[model samples]
Target: MQNKNHELHVICVNLLATLWDYNRVGKDAEDGDIEEIISMASKSDLADQEKQVQENIHSQITNFCTFMDQILLPESKSHETTSQKHSTAPRPSGLSLAIGRNAPPDTKFEIPETKPLTFAESCQRIKDLMGYTLELKPSQIPHEQAGQGLFVDGEADVGSVIALYPGVIYSPAYYRYIPGYPRVDSQNPYLITRYDGTVINGQPWGTGGETREPWAHSNVYRPNPSEPPSETGSDRVWKMLSKPLEGSRLGFNGEVLERRNPLALGHFANHPAMVMEPNVMVCPYDFPLNEKGMRAYIPNVVFGGVEEVKMKRFGSFWFKSRGESNDGQMTGPVMKSLALVATRLICNEEVYLNYRLSNSKRRPSWYTPVDEDEDRRRWS
Candidate 1:
């Protein structure tokens, strides 16, 4: 139940994050603003909201678990006593019984070398043939304990298609090996080589790969971790477009891109201009401030980091399944939902909210007494 709620909160945040990216329009923002918005919406500010959502989700999940427990209480109690023994009938397998992998051959699948067929094409061919042969979709194997026999309907040629393919199978890891790939770890659900030259469960013979690759994660997609920052095209754009909001003295000078001379990792970590501030890991509601106070200040602090922008953007899409189930499955939608919800309560009423101050019908911001306790500040 706890796990279920955590999953729900993650799904909710993913939904909001997806919405944020999808809603982006107007002219391209200055890099700093883009980074700031991305970071705040996806990572920094939402961290607090995610925490609160997780708590709520957990509470709901606990209630659900409790309800389920109550419903099954009579059956459980009866199982312990001889007077009212529950009938011990065979349990019905949900979906797994239809298609499964049981005692599959020591299968050696060799690739036909003319050209490598993609994993999808191979799977599709198998599906097309299944019309004549007796077999079920791979997903059903989970509910059926019958194992690999699920692929066979009293005797059908399942191995014929699998044998024509290369040892390489598509799983999360194999995606990296594809041309123009990003930060995929080598060890993964797919195997580069078939272990022991045989197939098991109609997938592969080998043990699962060693990589800690999270599916649909942005960190693993753009800005491949193995590549240097200088070589990254996206990083170049991130740097060039980064600047102060478009009307202040700093904004006009393009000084936000100015790097400090002496710092080794550029000026961000060590420069006098880049002050070191504590980063709170929790989400908005979990933090000390109320929603209005948090909304007003968090946007500024969250958008502060240029590098963090991509992570926030990527995280929005990282966790999702495709098609009808795709709704709110990604982080983008999740952040957008939060932003939309907060917008009503915290009015950012400046006419120039989306524009540079010089271009807007608005008064210049004045330096006033800062709400020291309410605002959260951080340095990149």
Candidate 2:
């Protein structure tokens, strides 16, 4: 398994005192009284320590991002600007990609180690090389009540980073703000939590977009409780967050970004079936917002207020199969976000991920435990 996908895994299991504090405060603090607690947690000494780890995470994610940027380029850049010529043709969605044939024998696939690059530099180089982005056709999931699944427009190698989960990032401190609160998932299936307590509400970010735009979301959408339905508890998605907000104004919580990063659709990935193993796994990627230039490709915004909360520690992943979730890797404190990296080479087929639901909770009819032991350990 040379170049095994997620060899770095992107998870750290340190006690993350600040992270746990947020988790505790989010669940316990009375509404409107949490700002001070969160403020204190954000400035903790541990928070400073988390920043150190974040630096390494920044390097690791960019390395993988650039690596994916290189191998996913399947067309010859010299071939008539394939990205523009094929506007109607399928492009990679959930991540940026240019149309290309697989690299020829002489292409320089190896990135030089002597020169380290900022994420902005790596992203810009890839953008200049590949012109257009965002193409894909989803396939209807084969089970009853299942939603459509994300399908890549082109092939990617086994270790490639596939789609990024785009949306409003809600750290543990602000979990109460998520519409539906303790039952957030009841009204929104687009929510995904990191190994740490951070939660990403993809409900605000649809399939991304075709061009760059400034963005933010309420992170406060909940289902319309009174809506009529054909079946009991049949449907929700009411009181929703506004679709990707657009404007030229910049703020502490907003920025213009490309919506077509081919990997922006990680939220669209569905759970694998009982007999099927997941082809991709979730990795928490901490994006450094300080890099102004790279903002265009990152499809996310921090929820208001907690934008400054620095995660000081990480928690364990519930999955035993993900045994690599070790505290020895305790790394930086940045705005933690989620992304899906391929576990094996993925062709233009549907992408599947493990939801790893808690056994104590009521699961949907279609939900099947990927591993029974994992469910117990995760919720234990």
- The model with the greatest TM-score is 2
lDDT of 1 at 239: 41
Model 2 worst lDDT run, 10 consecutive residues? 241-250
Clashes of 2: 28
Candidate 2 matches the true fold with a TM-score of: 0.55
Per-residue lDDT tens digits of candidate 2, residues 1-380? 11121121222212222333444454456755556655665565644645644553454345444443343333453232322423432322211110112212232222111223333343344434433122345445567766667775456554355667888776554454566754678868999877656788888778665444445342243233444423223112111111111121112323445554655778888888768777877656777544432444567766533223333222311111224334546343345687676666566678888888877777888778888875565566
Estimate candidate 1's RMSD in Å.
Answer: 26.8
How many backbone clashes does every candidate have?
A: 42, 28
